[model samples]
Target: MLLALPPLYLKYFEDGYLLVPGFWTIFFFISALTLIVFVVVLTVQQKNNEMYAQAFLGATTFKLLACLIFVLIFIKKGRPEKLFFVADFMYLYFLNTVFEIYGLLRTLRNQNSK
Candidate 1:
């Protein structure tokens, strides 16, 4: 699926900068998908939500950092390219998707345990 994007993305890059590499789109997609595995793994991997949440928070913080860098780059350019401005949000979106999935899984576990 990822391999399918570059030519199409390049076709549209004329419309605007892609911000992150084409590879990251695949990575974000894959990473977001892992939350199901994450939830399943949680049953055996970590003993509690706090540990998982902490790790997830740290990872999400990194995603935000990557977005912030692109934002800073866009800011430094002064003109602020519209494509990057929008692309920058993908990081937040990816992080939010993962965080929400994790949160929902945790909630489900807590509810089920009770």
Candidate 2:
């Protein structure tokens, strides 16, 4: 939710310059995917620490593929403008990727300490 504020503010207050159509849908999809990946990684960490790296790699690959498919479909169906596409891509993928890394690192740190 915190990641949503900047885009939301830009969309509403800045005349919707940086947002594409269906921004909420894109946001929710990424959010759900991130949450699912995080949960799967943590479950793997708890169940088999030695397999954590493989699980994380698998999850990351799945996320990238899913995002690629989603972007292709969105481009075909939504026909969003180039600027909107760039903004949406950065917000949806880049920010989420950063968040996922931060979350994974924090979780791993906590697990190691315990």
Candidate 3:
């Protein structure tokens, strides 16, 4: 998610890499959102704990920045092709979300079993 920001937003929107393979971008978006949500729920569960709370807020801020940057780029692009890429990006976001959810669940189960 955060690791892939430059290519997804900067390259795709700013440098016109919109025509490149979008599988990575899609995976990134989904992964980013999933982690964002996971961090959020974890934060809520550990509401009174400062360490986890800080991490969650940090992640929320990053995700918010990414969303803002995305919207800003879209406003500047303003084209049908751009819209197409955005859809592809969003599709990947959800796919990554599911994968992250499964991964986190597996991690929890493993820790419990151990």
Candidate 4:
């Protein structure tokens, strides 16, 4: 829903195809990271419960660095509505981060109950 809404707005009300493609790219990038994090955390949790936290932290650092690199690359590409791009990027980043944290919390809760 988050990924699709922007494009609809752009198509009906905007002039460019900027936000749609960029949002899709970022959405997939973040989705991949989320999957990797879940897999790594689940593996470590199963293999050595003591390492689960560390695994989560490592994955988070990786995601943060990846996002930074992505932003840097976008900035280096050109000066096409730089502020809007950054703002949209940050908004999506925050939305995804919150979603991830919510998922993590739910996972942790389930684990604790078990």
Better of 1 and 3 by TM-score: 3
Ordered list by lDDT, greatest first: 2, 4, 3, 1
Can you write out model 2's per-residue Cα lDDT over 1-114, one digit (the tens) per residue?
788898878877898866888888888888888988999999999999999999999999999898889889988998998887877787778888889999999989998997
> How much RMSD separates candidate 1 from the native structure?
6.6
Better of 1 and 2 by lDDT: 2
Let me know the TM-score candidate 4 reaches against the reference structure: 0.78
Question: What is candidate 2's TM-score against the reference?
Answer: 0.94
Candidate number that wins on TM-score, 1 or 4: 4
lDDT of 1 by residue, 1-114 (tens): 333364357557664345434435434543554454455546533566456656555654665566567556645655555566455555445555656566667766885698
Clashes of 3: 3
TM, every model:
0.39, 0.94, 0.43, 0.78
Model 1 — TM-score against the truth?
0.39
* Candidate whose TM-score is highest: 2
Select the stronger candidate by lDDT from 3 and 4: 4
What TM-score does candidate 3 reach? 0.43
